[model samples]
Target: MKKILPLSATALAALIALSGCSTDTNGSSMPGMDHGSSAMSTAPPTNVGTETGADHNAADAMFAQSMLPHHSQAVEMSDIMLAKPGMDAKIVSLAKDIKAAQGPEITTMTNFLNSWGESTTMTGNHSMAGMLAGTDLDKLKASQGTEAAKMFLTQMTAHHEGALEMAKIEVSGGKNAEAVTLAKSIVSSQEAEIKAMTELLATL
Candidate 1:
């Protein structure tokens, strides 16, 4: 005759422990069992802060797209003047200002485009204000001494004016507060630069 004994408390506890130690089909530790480390230990923790998305409209998109190349051409014009010999100290200083200010602005506008999931390139046949024709750039590049400085001032004044026109559109129509702020800055700064260039051109 065989005698069957009911499972003891110690034996039941052992069974429970074994079941808790069992793993899933994917080899991950079963729930309620501590693996002695965080489950996310395999990868470093990420910290994406509480940042909300930007709210932009079509006008904001247009402002970024148009302004990028406008600023780039301004930088290019500044470079042309900087590369020349015998530039006036004031003119040189202005060129440096344009380069310093617009360089960061280009990056800012690019970020606006990226955040909006928009293309950085302008769509359709858009004409930018204050843009130098290829021949105008060639003319400016070929000049020397005071002539180069005068040409740069003349060209940049017009370029800045063009920027003002575009910026006005952004100020009036843009939805993003940041873009409008930048537009206001461009209007104020470039207006002052335009006046300074006009005075400098007279001296040249």
Candidate 2:
């Protein structure tokens, strides 16, 4: 289920402005707002697809670009657990939830990029916070029984923290309203899961 934030319109607009947009009073585009392809200048292209352009920006693009892979890794992690034997029921459920929630988000962000005339593919070498290292994944793959469950929890906690970092960046710097909203949702949902994982970790 999606969590609804209590942010008012004024608050949401204020956040977008703080992200460095320069919208007019009616929340339309500001003429001189920078539209560079960096995270700093994302305001929806003024005339990308519609008769009037969608209100989004580079921060939105970065959020989507970074998050798509981030979410994909999470789903992959979930799949790893699901494919293994003798997993704890609780951990299996958690993995399923993470996979279910993130799969749709990946698609939504893909659509967001397609609509903006932006390539969904990110360029250059980049590192995202919380992604499992190759060795980390290998360790999880090699483990079995309780050790496997323990490894998954430990690794996924770090993974979720990395997601929180990315989401926070999007919340503070993104320009697209929908993108910002998703960022807030990620923060809320993932934080709860982190708590659950922490508690589960203590028992193991």
Candidate 3:
């Protein structure tokens, strides 16, 4: 009976030790569960697009809005130059390049305004520099040959100058990365074109 009693107590001790081991295993698993929860909680935010999409300011909006009409007028003038007969080959090529470049840019600016929830049209009576008066356009349309080439070059030079002014403003104050990059490109390309036109005017 004494031996039986000690064996019974020994079994009880063994059972208690096994129960303690089970409790320790469960306690260890709790840390892993907590780590998993922490990983989920620290996951990156899902609204990155919203943050990137709103990265524009008033200057960017104005650049897109005001440049839309300015670019359109330039395209119109290029078209008029292209339709004229016996135009200078250089002038014709320049007109074609202007139309090609500004047409896509107009679309890009329109998309920018639309995405920004801003009006595509300029609201005030702000006169854009180098905009041709109807009379000026009439004079350009009436002229022919070298006269037309000279007129187009002179007018386009002024137009490019106005664009450079606007682009410089955008480069200085615009918040959108794409808009600023575009403004820089305009400054570079238009400055070169202006120099070319000046040389062409001298030749004429």
Q: Can you write out model 3's per-residue Cα lDDT over 97-125, one digit (the tens) per residue?
A: 99988899888888887777789998878
TM-score of each: 0.74, 0.74, 0.74
Off by over 4 Å in 1: 1-54
CA displacement after TM-score superposition, residue 94 of candidate 2 (Å): 0.6
State the RMSD for candidate 2. 17.7
Clashing pairs in 3: none
- The digit string of per-residue lDDT tens for model 1 on 57-99 reads 8899999999999999999999988888777888889999999
Candidate closest to the true structure, highest lDDT: 3
Q: What's every prediction's RMSD, in angstroms?
A: 8.3, 17.7, 12.1
Question: Which residue pairs collide in model 1, if any?
Answer: none
TM-score of 2: 0.74
Score candidate 3 by TM-score against the native.
0.74
Clashes of each: 0, 6, 0
Instruction: Give the range of the ten consecutive residues with the poorest summed lDDT in model 1.
Output: 43-52
